[model samples]
Target: MTYWQMRLALLRHPISAALAAVNQSGLFVVAIMGTALPAVFFLILLNFGILLDATQPSPSRLPILLHLILLQLLLIGLMRDAILGSKARLLLISVPGHQADHKVSMLLATLVNPLLWPPLFILLSTSPTNWPLMGAQWLLPVLLLGIQWSGLFAPAPSLVYLSLIFLLSLLPLSQPMATWLLSEQGMITLLLMLLLCQKLPIRTLFNRLQRLLSHLPLPVSSYIAQSVIRQELHGLVLRLTLALMIVAAGHLVQTQVAQFSGEVQTLTVSLLAVIAASWQLPLNRFLSAKREFLLSLPQSKICRATLLGQPLLLGLLLFQFWLHHGEHCWLQIGLLIMQISLIQIVTIRAERQFVLASLISTCAAMVLFVTLAN
Candidate 1:
């Protein structure tokens, strides 16, 4: 098969495609949230020092803003590589795809997607004079992505690149540099880096991984476990890390001053992550697919019982986080209960209408959340 055909086939892989479709709905939820001033303000408060806080003398939005930008960049980067990718697909590409010439498609996959550019545009629209930093912004991540893509054969790339972003998170930049990194320039630089990383004999390594994934029972178990962890576990880690990093950055800026107490904001952010992650259950996919044997009425009742049990289980766990962090834990706990149930029920009911179900469920939950806020 030709290379383009191979790449398309890989993108069509079930796990990657299904998750991408779900995330698309999640992104829709985000855009809707952006329209609410209170939601946006509250989110900024979670990460950023309020620009007008009268009590703190040494306050600036720069650190928090920069951290926010970097966190989003890291998230979208991983989504491009991981949620939208499968090792099996990459393996197929590496075999029949192209050894050295796959750079163009790789670049396209990274930079030329639907939801990325508008955010990049908004970020860049801030300042036209800070163009060089823009280039650096894209370059830094792409370079890291390249290093990451190259090392994906072994375990080194992900750790190394994550470490690199973590270290970069600790660095302080001037306003202009920060502005540049916040724009399309940053996105391009990161994409090009991934393209460069494809210079390796990825096909050969992919063939090896594919073989390993298929042959031994141990390998099979590992892949299955990896799939579950990637789908369920680290999904929370991704958002939680963003919250923690922002809190950490805010703390660093405030250490020189004694007046700042950002604990409430930090706590709010942590809870925010917990709530967001709870909504990522695979209920829609579960109900939509008939790949498994059909449940009898009794069996369906048991399964529904288990599904209803999810919100309770999630609430208890989230309560532990909320109990330590902030007030209104009960309110959020109640909100989570409603949100999960609505999401799960809507997803199941709208089984084949995955997108419509998520959109309706999310909007309904958001309305309830806003009502509670008022």
Candidate 2:
């Protein structure tokens, strides 16, 4: 493919797959939104309070700057696979000028990021007075992309760069400096300056880190599981964040709402269990992609199960702690575990048809929740 064609393909493939997944799991989407929407609203209201408080003239830029960093980090994580995946690596090796092309394509892709731009525009709309600060925030994802590249190519420099940025943000800037920092043109200049400061051989540093990791003595199952988690660490982190949000929200509601129904609390616990176990989707996808190769190895089944079970077991322990006060907590826990285990198994067998499997699993979980609540 030509460079443009390759870029288009890279950009279009994920969108197409996401649409297909969405079409396959309309019910899944509804279920997730239903479970997550209340907590999401709570977060928005909470953040709105903070936003109102921070909207003063000469507001402390730290929180807004920190918000920029958080949003950029999330954007980088969501797009990491596309930006640095196997296809990108292959393109870099095979296509002339692919280094520049790939970087440009990834940057262009981030332009449409649901996680990054929407919130930014929303913030801009809400806080029109802080337009300059919002303008400065636009360059952050670019800066973060550079940091991601640095981490991939030169880990040490990336750390230094992050520390420097953090320190600079903490320092009090004079009015002129602050104005310049918040200006789009000046922020771009600053970004370029910082990029120039990181003079390190990225590949050499990354290879060294790889060599160091290679020597770690881990059990086979642990090593394999860790590898999968590392590969999809960003997505896993987001899932964990969502899971935590659900648990926290649920806990808050349970403690504060005297009129909270037992059925709703039980359903919340059930949803928490499902969310925790949903890590299996990515894990199973990874394993299923390598299924033939893995099946050829001795004791592969044990390794696969161990890879799948470890997270579930840990999640179960957490659920037990969280639910110890509930009526028939053990029974609820047992049903939740069974529902999650069933979902995981079904997802594994469904192979590349993960979306369909997810829909089925979601339906199964809802049924289990209803039964338990009754």
TM-score top scorer: 2
Per residue, candidate 2 scores C-alpha lDDT tens digits across 189-305 of 757755765775656877998799789885677777777878877655455444444554454455446564455456565665565556676776777688887788677888788
The lDDT of each candidate is: 0.45, 0.56
Please give, for residues 37-148, the per-residue lDDT of candidate 1 as tens digits: 5754455443333321213332243344334434444444444444334555556546654664346445544553322343344445547776554453334334434443
- What TM-score would each prediction reach against the true structure? 0.40, 0.50
User: Which ranges in model 2 have alpha carbons more than 4 Å from their true place?
Assistant: 1-9, 19-52, 55-74, 80-103, 106-110, 118-217, 226-272, 281-305, 313-342, 345-374
Q: Against the correct fold, how does model 2 do in TM-score?
A: 0.50
Give the TM-score comparing model 1 with the true structure, all chains together.
Answer: 0.40
Once model 1 is optimally superposed onto the true structure by TM-score, how far is the C-alpha of residue 114 displaced, in angstroms? 8.2
